[model samples]
Each structure stands twice: as structure tokens, then as C-alpha cells.
Target: MLRADNLTKKYGDFTALNGLDLSVNEGDIFCLLGANGAGKSTTINLFLNFIEPTDGQASINAMDVTLHDRETKQLLSYIPENLMLYPHLTGLENLDFFCGLGGKSHTQDQLESLLRESGLQADFIHRRVSSYSKGMRQKVGIALACAREASVLLLDEPTSGLDPKASNEFSELLLTMKKRGVATLMATHDLFRAKDTGTHIGIMKEGVLVEQFASEEVSFRDLEKLYLQHMHN
Candidate 1:
């Protein structure tokens, strides 16, 4: 399970997050939506420990993030909006080296299979990242996350640059992972994808979670309307 207990962040007199609390269970995809500067990224950053909280706690499986940095990091795999890789290196080598940096090593065949599982084309596995498209790079990012073998997956704008077909493929990969009991917390601007992929949805406004809804209870169109209503108010 992943939980954020009244997590708060402040910048001098400005508050980026205030008493934001959430819980995501295994096999759950919790998609967060918000207008610009709503603190969706801040919430994810708190879990990644990129920034310390002014108050409250974020944890995985009940392991407090502040006290369990190494252990918490071990349980998480983060895919940022722009997943950076060495353009000079082939996809395989990039995954190999990055995962190795995290103390994970894999055989060539294993790496290829993992990439394919994450929706990368088998043919592109040997291509240099410079020649690959955005969707391809994101696939490699997801592949690395898979290689990390963590209990939780954090996706930030995960489908930002993919074509319709590619985006659908990525969504399918996420659904597949959910079936395997992986916890997912995705911060995205795409409400359509959020409704389809999210087991739960949250709307953040000006550093607060103003509203939340269950995916099963609200249709995608309804969620969009509700999202706009929250953003406008």
C-alpha cells in the first residue's frame, strides 16, 4: 500500500501542498488531475523524496518515507514526464546501465524480454535512443521500472507524447501490471486516460485536493465535467 498522511509543503509564505492525504492499495491505479500549479507534482515529489515536507508523512507499505529513504526508494520506480536516456546508447544498454546503477543486473535476453513486456517493439530494442521516438523512450522508461521490480510505480505524465495506438498500448501495459498487484500513482493532464485507467481520481486545486471520485462511480464524461467545475470554482 502507498499512503500520504496529511502531507504538506510550503515555500516561505506560499503553500504548495496543504494537508493532502491519500492512500493507494496494491493493484490500484490512483490518477491525479489538477490545473496548473495545483501541486500534483509536489505530491509525487514528496513520495520520491525530491523535496521534504514541512509537515506530515508519505510512506509505502507503512514504511515512513522520512525515516526509510533507502528502503522506500527500493520499493518505488518513478517515470518522470520527460524520461531522459543517453542518446548515444542503444535502448538495451540504457536499461542495462540504469538498472545496474540501482543494483540490478540482467542478461541480454532478459533485458530484451522486459522491454517488450513494457510495450517496446522488439525491433527497436537494439536501436540508439537518439533515433527512437518519444513513445519509444517512455517504453524504455517503463522497462527500467519493470527491471527495478518495485512494489509501486509512479508515473508523471506517462502518456504525454504517444500516438493513439502507442498510448493505448501503454495503458494496456499499466492494466497488466495492476493485475499483477503493482501500486500505481499517476499524475497526468489527460482526463480521458485517467478515467479509463484510474481506480480512483483526485482533483487538486491551488495546493489542495478539492475533490475526489471513484472511477467506477463516475463516467469519464462526468469526471471531466466535475474536474472543470472544481477547477473553475
Candidate 2:
């Protein structure tokens, strides 16, 4: 679970986030939508303690992110817009490296199994990342998160460059994580993916949360219309 109360951040004259308040419960897929510089990543950065908030506070399960940085970080796993892998290493090797970095060491087979769990195919397990596609790389990213047993997943445009099949597979993997009750906070530009994968959606603009809704309470079509109106406001 995560909560932010009146969260605000500013860079001199530029306000990245302003009085943004939100709560994400366990197993909730919260999609944060906005234009190019709507402070989506700023919110994440504040929560991740990558940047300290100029105002207000963010917490993970009642622990303040700023005050309890280590504990809060341990509760989260992040997938940024662009993930980097060791180009020369195999997919399984990448998985092992990140897992070990997290103070968890798994054997070769264990890491490969973790990859399989994240929907990475066994056949592609040993191939170099240099030869893998974008989607394949992201699958390994997800595999790293699972291997670390992260409780909260923060993703930014996770499905961006994937082909159709890979995108769908990635979506299915997210569904599995949801079933397992991992709280997910995702910032994505793909509306269709947000519609199907998100339990709730929030529209943000100029550092403010303009509107929000439960997926069940509003149709995707209506959300799109509202999104259009909000951005142009």
C-alpha cells in the first residue's frame, strides 16, 4: 500500500508536482496518465526518494519514504521507460545480476525459472540481450522484479516498444502479478493498455491530478473523451 498527502515538488520556477494526493491499495493497478511533462515520473521519484519532496510526504505502508528510505525502497521494484541490460550478457545472466544486486542470490536454474515465471520463454533463456527485442528485454526486467519479490511495482510506459504479441504477453504477466496482490502504480501513454490493465485511472496535468475514476465506473471511451478535454483545458 502507498499513500501521498499533498505531495509537491518544485524546481525553482518550475513546478513538477503540486499538492498531488493519492492512495494505492494492495493489488490495485493505478494508471497515472498525462502529457509529456505532467510530473508522472516526479511523483515516482518522490516516492522512490530519488528526489526529496519540497512539500508534503509520501509513505509506503505507513513508513515515510523520506524518513525510511531503505525500508520503503525495499518494498518497491521499478521498471523505467527505458530499461538497460548488459548487452553482452544472456537474458538469464541479466536476471541473475540484478537479483544478486538486491542481496538475493539464485542459482542459474533458479534465475532461469524466475524468467519463466515472468513469461520469458525458456528457449530464449540463454540468448544475448544484444540480439533480443525491446519486449524481450522488458520481460527480463519484470523477471528481475519478481526475483526480488517486490511488493509494489512502479512502471513507466512498460509496453511502449513491444510488438503486439509481446505486448499482450506482457499484459498477461502484469495480470498474474495483480492476481498475486502486488500493488502496481504505472505511468503510461497507451490508453488501451490502461483501460484493460488498470483498475483505476488518474489524469494529471501541470502537476495536478485533474480527474480520476474506477475503470468499472467509467468506460474506456468516456475516459478517452475526458482525457482529451482535460489536456486541452
Candidate 3:
């Protein structure tokens, strides 16, 4: 459902991403692991059309992202490193507002159901977003994705601040989305979570994809060792 074809991006003398060819099909969770300036976020920005690609293309469902910006956006959802929401609004209110932006309108009960399915506690749905923990805010973000019926999810540093329990819960929620055939491309620094939730894993270095493989084929220790080796080179 998501694809990057020879995707390259350069800011004058600095290349943020280079010749990245990737595909994330329905029900697949592709985890991108890399250090700072490794181009993970740049790839996502290309797909998001937040910035134009210098060369090549990013697409959703065979539709060119740059060319079909509006149509492509309707097919996917994005959750950045810091998920933003109106601090004064309740979780339910936030859902209602975001979904509305996508031209979707849901009843209160239906909206509440989405939040619950995303792992937010029932009582917390009515609480103001400013009072939410990072994990709780992420759940509401997931609910927004669900409300949009988005087939593709682009996540950057999704588990950066979560505790072990919250992180595990987040992983479980991602698996649930995968079961429903959501194609997920997650950029994360957490190798353990990548191993737990990803179907495929990719490592990037200096703006290029250096290695990729099926996640099930490698143990966590092995993956970590390889990641460290790439970082040092």
C-alpha cells in the first residue's frame, strides 16, 4: 500500500535520502531503524509530501504522492514523533474534529468505540487531552487513524517516550491494526519493539538503506549487533 521508488532527496550539498526503493504491502509492518540524520524521517516526509523529492517518487496504492497529493493523503495517516492535539479538547472531541477534517462524521458512541479499540481507557475518553500521558495521547492518535479508515500508517519514533508496559501495549495495538490489513511503515530507534511488531526490518546509514530482511529470520541480539556495526561504520 506504500512504496518508495528510487526515492532521493537533497538539500543543496546535503543529501537527506538517496535512491530508496521500498514497498509496504497490506498487513505488513516495515520497521526502519537508524540513528540521527539517517534519512528515515526524510523518506516519510517524501511520502507525506511535506517536502518535494529531489528525484524518484513516493506513492500510496499506485498513486503518485507528489502528483496525487490530495487523493494520496486520503489513503493514509501520519503520526509524528510528537503527536499534536488540541490541549483543551477532550479525547472524544479531538477524534470528532480530526475525523471531520477528513470529511467523516461519527456519532459520539462510534467515536468512543474507536478510542476504546485503540486501547484508551473508558474513563479517560472524556478527560482533557492536556491531562493525557504520551501513551494515552498516542492511543487517541490511533483512534483518529481508525476513524479515517486509513489503510496506510506512517509512524516516526512512535515509542520514544513510553515505559515498558505502555510500549508493549502500543505494540499490541499495532498488531491489531496489522490484522485488519493496515500497511504500516514505522521509523523507530527501539530495536526490541521493532522485533516484536515488525514483519520486515530495515537499517539505514548516512541517508541510504544499508540492509533489510525479514524480521522473523533474526533474533533481537543479532539485529542489535548488526545495527551497532552499521552505526559505527
Best by lDDT: 3
The TM-score measured for candidate 2 stands at 0.96
lDDT measured at residue 142 in model 3 versus the true structure, 0 to 100: 86
Global fold similarity of model 3 (TM-score)? 0.98
List ranges where model 3 is wrong by over 4 Å: none
Residues 1-233 of candidate 2 have per-residue lDDT tens digits of 98989999999999999999999988899999999899888988888899999999999988999999988888788888777899999998888877887788888978888888877778899998898888888889888878888889989888888788988998898888888889999988888888999998999999998888887788889888999999898
Weakest lDDT window of 10 consecutive positions for candidate 3: 75-84
Give a tens-digit lDDT track for model 3, residues 91-202. 9999999999999889999999999988899999999999999999988988898899999999998889989998898899899889989999999999999998999999
Tell me the lDDT of candidate 1.
0.90
Q: In candidate 2, which residue ranges exceed 4 Å CA deviation? A: none
lDDT of 2 at 135: 84
For candidate 1, list the clashing residue pairs, or say none.
Answer: none
Better of 2 and 3 by TM-score: 3
- In model 2, which range of ten residues has the least summed lDDT? 93-102
Question: Which candidate tops TM-score?
Answer: 3
